[model samples]
Target: MNTVEWSDALLLDYEPMDTVHREFVDLLAAAQNASDAALPQTWAAVVAHTVRHFGHEDEWMQRTGFASADNHIMQHRVVLNLLREGLAMAQAGQMDPVREMAGELAAWFAKHTQTLDAALALHMRREPPPVATVHRPRGGRGAHASPG
Candidate 1:
């Protein structure tokens, strides 16, 4: 089973944002190591969650008028498309692709969170905290966390 652990280093200095990101990591680990019995649904949820998480981040960046928003959105699109293809494979009963995809995503996100995401987080931290309410909205990749 894939194991996911969280540390303060992953924190982007924004509590709500970090919470979602940590959950994303946890899902990545869980989806990677999950048994065949849980593979299909779990894989779908991971894909969905990632898409939504990207959306959330994009919305935040747009609202804040972050200069790097375009680059960030492009990265998100590419990753999500890759994930969607992986999910499609999993749904077609090819589990191996899921393993490979999950590993790649984990590595990518780890480096991404530590760098780009962290930079954005640090910038947000310097600004006054916004009054944004975060809730899991409908039509997203379904995954569960103990709420960060």
Candidate 2:
């Protein structure tokens, strides 16, 4: 049970996106509740899920001509970078920072979902894109498959 719960306020009314978001919340909570011995691994899981989660959203934004694609993707990059940094610190036997980052992410996610993601959901509803064109990119870590 992390600070960020999967409440209706977080739902975007878009099935695929909402499903991914719910998974993100679950993974995050798993990390937050893991024991000291499990923290690093749990945190890593969170990072991995987030990488994919953000990638999905980023792809959707790109496909839907989201007006704030640049800003939104930049935020994703920064957050992913920070999460990776936390993972590194955790691997080096420094868990406090990762814990703190989890809390910060809880706060940040609440706002991000409510605002940026909400707007994207609204746009998508108005102008739905073909599902086939939204694959994740390839190459490198968290790479998305090419858009079809």
Candidate 3:
């Protein structure tokens, strides 16, 4: 069996994030099942995707002023750092460490998605987007300047 499998519990109802999460699960499973020769590359792919994954979420949190942004971002940073370390370990011919980490990562991902990401997705769905009111020309005959 794979270390991680995609299920409804993993779905956040945020399509963008759900899609990324699916990719993460698949890549992690691939890493977990990879042979010695393919392990490093599989792990590397997971690391690369996670960098982008966390980055996009962090950016969204910042942009939307998510209430728990700081703590959520901290968790992402710490986890991503550990993942990067695992990638290095994989590259160094130490396969067992990263293999173990893959399992740990799956557990972490489950909780992280259920709590932090779910909250973020709910916040995103509930919160109104940033204000960018369209401006009409004065009297319909002059230039309009939009607020920054």
lDDT of 3 at 138: 73
Q: Name the weakest run of 10 consecutive residues (lDDT summed) in model 3.
A: 137-146
- For 3-110, candidate 1 gives per-residue lDDT tens digits of 456777677778868989988977877787789768878888888899789998888788888878888889999999998888788878899877877877777887
Give the per-residue lDDT of model 3 (tens digit) for 59-88.
Answer: 999998899999999999999999999999
Give lDDT per model, in order: 0.80, 0.87, 0.91
Where does model 1 exceed 4 Å of error?
Answer: 1-4, 131-148
Using Cα atoms with residue i matched to residue i, what is each candidate's TM-score against the true structure? 0.80, 0.85, 0.85
Q: What TM-score does candidate 1 get on C-alpha atoms?
A: 0.80
Candidate 3 or 1, higher TM-score: 3
lDDT of 2 by residue, 1-148 (tens): 2376789999899888899999888888888888878999999999999999999889988877789999999999999999999999888888888888898999899999999989888888888458565445455445555568
Better of 1 and 2 by TM-score: 2
Give per-candidate clash totals: 2, 6, 0
